[model samples]
Target chain A: MLAKRIIPCLDVKDGKTVKGVQFVNFRDAGDPVELGKQYSELGADELVYLDITASHEGRKTFTELVQRIAAEVSIPFTVGGGIHELSDVERLLAAGADKVSINSSAIRRPELISEIAARFGVQECVCAIDARLEDDGQWRCYLNGGRIPTERTLFEWAHEAQERGAGEILFTSMNHDGSKQGFAIDALRRLHEELSIPVIASGGAGTKQHFLDVFQQAHVDAALAASVFHFNEIPMAELKQFLADEGVVVRQTCK
Target chain B: MVAIVKYNAGNIYSVFCACKRLGYEPVITDDPELLRSADKVIFPGVGEARAAMEYLNATGLADVIRSLKQPVLGICIGMQLMCRHSEEGDVDCLGIFDAPVERFRPTSAVDKVPQMGWNTVSANGASDKNCLFEGVADGAYVYYVHSYRVPVCADTIATTDYCGEYSAALHKGNFYATQFHPEKSGSVGEQILKNFLAL
Candidate 1:
């Protein structure tokens, strides 16, 4: 049976680990490599290192950091943020990153999705959509780390991304992210219902029950969180136990 | 030293790292001499079948791979290309195993095409047990990410259920193939790698 995945997203900035509240007020977390190694040991199914750094030098550093993590850690990981073209994807994959998540640039040039899928199998490109629920009760996709809004709604963009050869959709609810209340259950349920590709739910994971809610209610392929796992609010093993006891099929790592 | 056969594929870096983690200085090469002489050869691939076949045939490593007498392990697309044929590109494969590869046409809407994430593998009746899964438990979880799969056949040593039962692992003579990524499978995968190294 295919088990639901648990991914710890490490937001990397300036070659160090950091997490911001709603994409602002960033604070130092720790070294990304160390944090990744810890997560791998503590039973993280996969890791996502979002390179929040935008500078040219920052990308170079992130690529080098990818090599270090790949060499030391024994698990799959996805690298995102600052990937603008095929060359960026090539460099990151060459650096040993398994998958590359594309956001703003992909929205700017939708062809980037197909290009990546064609060159490197479709399974390698993850289309990450940062969306927020608007006043009209529609989820609007955002760009530039949720700074700017796009005309494409969450469902439409996710459907187009799937048609364009994206392996999966990483939908982050801007309204629920950092809120720690729970996941955007209703929006996520509709998104997965519409798209054929696997959907990885992200943004607001406050408790272990939230993981259960997203998986049971929405049937997402994976659930990802940053602060909950990073700050030791919910340990990976204990959470996995909670989910397993509650009857969610998650991969249990040996202690 | 173990040799990781390299062609026009994406990310053999993790395979190299996995071998390094097992304390072997595996060489990534298309050079026939290195691959032919190595203690073990791991043909790891992640790309389209037609292009990969072209690269293998062009470099003449395809024939060399067929002649390798030592244990050879194929992963994901590596396992696909080792089969008789693939529906992916409608191309002929290495024919190391008699099985043919087919693209997944999932019937249920909920069952995704590219089956991603961790899944369990059970030892079937292919043999009492495949040596590759010596220490690994039956129904042990491993990571997988692919769009194509091989249906159950006589060569199937292990089977996994997606939409239905498929050959998760196969063995024929000296060649071994898996539809999952053991390098990224964490502890269970580490044990499988240790068993392969012992072989």
Candidate 2:
């Protein structure tokens, strides 16, 4: 059986891994390469590096960090944030990043996704949608780390993203992020119901049981977290064991 | 030298990347002369079967691959195309492995397609401590992404379950393959590639 994935996300700024409380008041964590190496050895299924400073720096530091980390770890890693054009995709690929994720830049230039997918293939392009529920009980897509709202609905953009050749959809619920309550099962369920591509559920992981809930109830392909993993709330090996205990299939470390 | 038969596949770079990690630079080519002369051959793909077969037939590499005497390893679609037939394209395959590839049915309550992510592999009884699975335990997880699977057969060297049991890896004589993407599967994946290189 295909086991569900557990991914640890790292926010990269100027080639360093950083974390913040709900995407603000950032603090340095450690070297990107070193942290990635640690997580890889700890049985992290895959790693996601978001360039939080891409829009401000006018260049992506995540690309260089990906090169550094790729040299250290053998697993596949995805680089996102500030990816604006086809050349950016090319640069990330050349830097050894296995996949390129697009968010704000993707909304600003929708054709960028199609162009990159056409050139590099859909498997290499992951569309990261940061969404939040509106007062009307509808999910609206947000960009720029969930600060900017787009007119498109979450499902609409997701369908468009898939049609434009996105291999996977990385969805993070802004309302649930860092709350440690649980994943937004409704949002994940909606995406899983609508899209054919692999859906990676991100944001709001409070406990090992939360992973089981997401996998069992929502049927997501993967679950990604930052604070919980960074603070050592859940060790990858132990979590895998917990999931296994719960009858959720997971990858065990080679003994 | 090892030659990775390059058609229009998605995971080609990762295989070349894996070979590099294993300390050997494999030539990614479809050239007949280069492929025929290489010490080992790696056939890899990540796309629809019909298009892949079309590329193979168009390039004349199909004939070249069938006649090769050296060991050949296939990955994902590469493995599926080596079987007797595939429902994916309704086309005849390389017939190296006596099996058929079928698309996964949407019967699971899970609602997930492609069966993406990592899963464990149990060595088949016929496996003889082969190098390809060295450092990989019977249930160690490997990365996979596909909607179709190869059914159980005599050549099955390993098996995995998704919806139901399916061949995760296979070997017969000089031919071998894995439905999983070893190149993207972390250290365990690297070890599999290393084992293949050592063989």
Give the top-scoring candidate (lDDT): 1
Give lDDT tens digits, candidate 1, residues A1-255: 899999999989889888632312223336788778778888899999999887889988999999998998888999999998999999999999999999999999999999999999899999999998999999998999999999989988888899999998999999999999999999889888888899999988999989999999999999999988877788899999999999999988778
Question: What residue runs in model 2 are displaced by over 4 Å at the alpha carbon?
Answer: A20-29, A53-68, A85-95, A105-122, A160-165, A193-196, B89-93, B125-131
Residue-level lDDT tens digits of model 2 in A1-255: 677889999987787777632312223346777777677877888999888774545354565566666666777788887777888787877777778889988888888888976766667788999999999988889978888898878888999998998889999998899899999998898788778788999988999988999999888889999988887778778999999899987777754
Report the lDDT of model 2 for residue B24.
Answer: 93
- lDDT for A216 in candidate 1 is 96
Model 1 regions lying over 4 Å from their true place: A20-29, B124-126
RMSD of 1: 2.9
Q: How many residue pairs clash in all the candidates, one count each? A: 0, 2
Cα deviation of B50, candidate 1, in Å: 1.4
Each candidate's B-chain TM-score, in sequence, is 0.97, 0.95
